[model samples]
Target chain A: MQASMSCRPKWGICKMNQDLIQYLLRLGDSALIQGQRLCEWCGRAPALEEELALMNVGLDLVGQARNWLEYAAELANDGRDADHLAFRRDERAYRNLLLVEQPNGDFAVTVLKQFFYDAWHLAVLEGLTHSSDSRLQGIAAKAVKEVTYHLRRSSEWVERLGDGTEESHQRMLAAIPQLWRFTVELSDSDAVEQRLHAAGLIGDPQQIAAAWQQQVERTFDSATLPLPAPACHFYLSGRQGLHSEHLGLLLAEMQFLPRAYPDATW
Target chain B: MQPGDLIASDLGARAAAPGDLDQAWQVLGRVMDPEVPVVSVVELGIVRALAWDAGHLHVVVTPTYSGCPATEVIEADIRQALEDAGFRAPQLERQLHPAWTTDWITSTGRERLLAYGIAPPLGSANKRSLLGDNGSVNCPQCGSAHTELLSQFGSTACKALYRCCDCREPFDYFKCI
Candidate 1:
């Protein structure tokens, strides 16, 4: 059976040779959806400074999404631009991690989610900077800088809330356990990643996960939060466009303006 | 003039004077960034390449800030400015490789940023960003080194909010990346 033009491959198996495009979409969708989540906080963040910071970070990820998606469009050769790829796809076509799509439950939740994601982002990008693919290397190099700053900000918040007060600490503690399960899929390699890993175009998933583990352990230790045991049953498949129930609702809202008024320029 | 000489002369006349490349740079210099309004894109090192190709002018630009809101508008502005300066249908190619960095901002760009109340980056983006390194960043307002970070982000995506303790003036520090 032929894969649809818009939808990427199913998890653990992609028969098509369009590996680079698939890889790019994996990277792109995560950033794009993450950015969208942050945009949800545009006017609603706890403080004015936090509002500006979240929006800026959202813009950064969206920008990176544009970069990756633009390149993916070229590889896909389906005449779809970044806008179409972002706003026209169904949730089944989305390749973002489930961790990103999870609701921003509270400030504690946002901080924990961001800290976890940032560590992985920085580690993966750092490894990708040495990729045989020049485009991947360049994008990774540039992103490393941005995500470094992101990790710092989020981790500081993690520490602040963890060590702050009874309420803040309790909230952070509650936020971690629920979100920890989703991180398992982060570095769980599929056939696509395996092939790319062999070619030296993508980072080693194990190594990247290890780096993130070190960072997470350190942050949790400092935050005075207990590290939850890694999930025994990993929900192992967001990379192949398999996502949580949250994604469909997200795509509905994100695609609204574009779907309602086709070719709407904003 | 010989036939080849004639072709060259006609193309040159159509493009601009022999020094029109210089004139093109001048035109670029005058086109201020919409957001900052003080520094031109050329000064900021976003305009990477400018030349005549196949009897047409081609301008290559690397948009600064990965998802900077101003990327497209700035590109449009560049195209419009070049057309207004008589370089008709000049090609504009937006390249993304090696991504834009704060290090690319020229000394002139730094001065313009300072004058515009935005502090320039202290050093290279990579070095300043390594796990722990908050280098000395003197305030653009009062040239004070005693500045505190109010927020990681400022008025724009490329800046951080900083308040100068000495002058007590809040300012924007253009982030290294």
Candidate 2:
């Protein structure tokens, strides 16, 4: 897989190590997309407290995204900064998970989506803390603390919404299938991950998958929601630049100012 | 010397210093946190270390939170303070390893935070607390241990909104992270 042409520098050339760039994009784009999704709740969350919480979490994720993207930009060394990578890239160039790009349905759906992502995120960060790459280890070490809070908050919400009222529980139950199919991608590792794992730059896929499953099961037990069968077949794979229709729309809104003005700055 | 100055001096001795590094520490000790203006960045423990390399002062900093809006301001403020103190174009390095924790906030910083009406983080940033076992936060206003968390987040990423059961006053608790 070659580097996305759009990600190439304006001199019509790319001098990046393809595998490293791809790996960094996977880390950064996931955080960026997920952060943007959370920020969409700014003025619309159920209560003031929830609003603040959502935005705070969003801020953390975006900050982490900047860190990862900054490193990616450095590695690319292709005349693009983190902002350029974030705003200028086309939808097909993004490497975020399909789950994060999904719409924030109702509050229940949003919470469940966050819970699922947080579980996987914590597992990945915990693993990355032990990475052979010191830079990744440092980023992961810092992020693990923040994601721990995120997971705790989301998992508690899962229990609350799942066991709270007939309406809330039913809503949580309904949200399951709308989001569960995406879980397949959480544990699915392709060659990029396999190569990184072999080099000890990343965690073992089997261990990460096991940790993610254990976390989901523990939270599901507490939430009193029965676990559904894992989705076996899903052609969706965001890492390969295959995204749903939702991502293009999201990029249209998120990239509007930067794309329009080109030279805008605060 | 003030208690804050004492703590800063103690930390200053940790590094085998030239006169410049010690002076830099003194200068940073007066550079207050932008968000929590009552405490200096040194008191907050974000100024991780200071050194001189190739005729340039090198200061290492860590953000209190990953998404802290105040990080850039704090970095700029540190540079400005160093420059104002006669160091030419001091370099700032952001270190992410051994991630910043509330446990790093100094005792004097905690006292200043209480005096400023925000409760300092209770206990340590331990594994149990990270698992959501939040300890009791005492009211900074009335010195009562009876306080309830109004929200997990507050006006800033580093704080949680809390209301004192005794005085019925709402205050910010610096979250343990």
Native-referenced TM-scores of chain A, all candidate models: 0.92, 0.93
lDDT of 1 by residue, B153-174 (tens): 8988888898999999999888
- Listed models, DockQ each: 0.59, 0.64
For model 2, residues A95-186, the per-residue Cα lDDT tens digits are 99899999999999999999999998998888899988898898998899989989988999999999889999999999999999988888
List, residue by residue over A1-266, the lDDT tens digit for candidate 1: 24453445453333333787888888899999889999999889999999999998899899999888988897676788988899998887888888999998999998888888898888888888899988888887777778888898898999999989999999998998879899887656678788888888889988988998899889888999998777554544678777888888889999999999998665
Which ranges in model 1 have alpha carbons more than 4 Å from their true place?
Answer: A1-16, A234-236, B1-19, B130-132
Docking class of 1: medium
Residue B10 of model 2: what lDDT? Answer: 44
- Model 2: reference contacts kept, as a fraction: 0.80
Give me the chain B TM-score of candidate 1.
Answer: 0.86
Candidate 1, DockQ to 2 decimals?
0.59
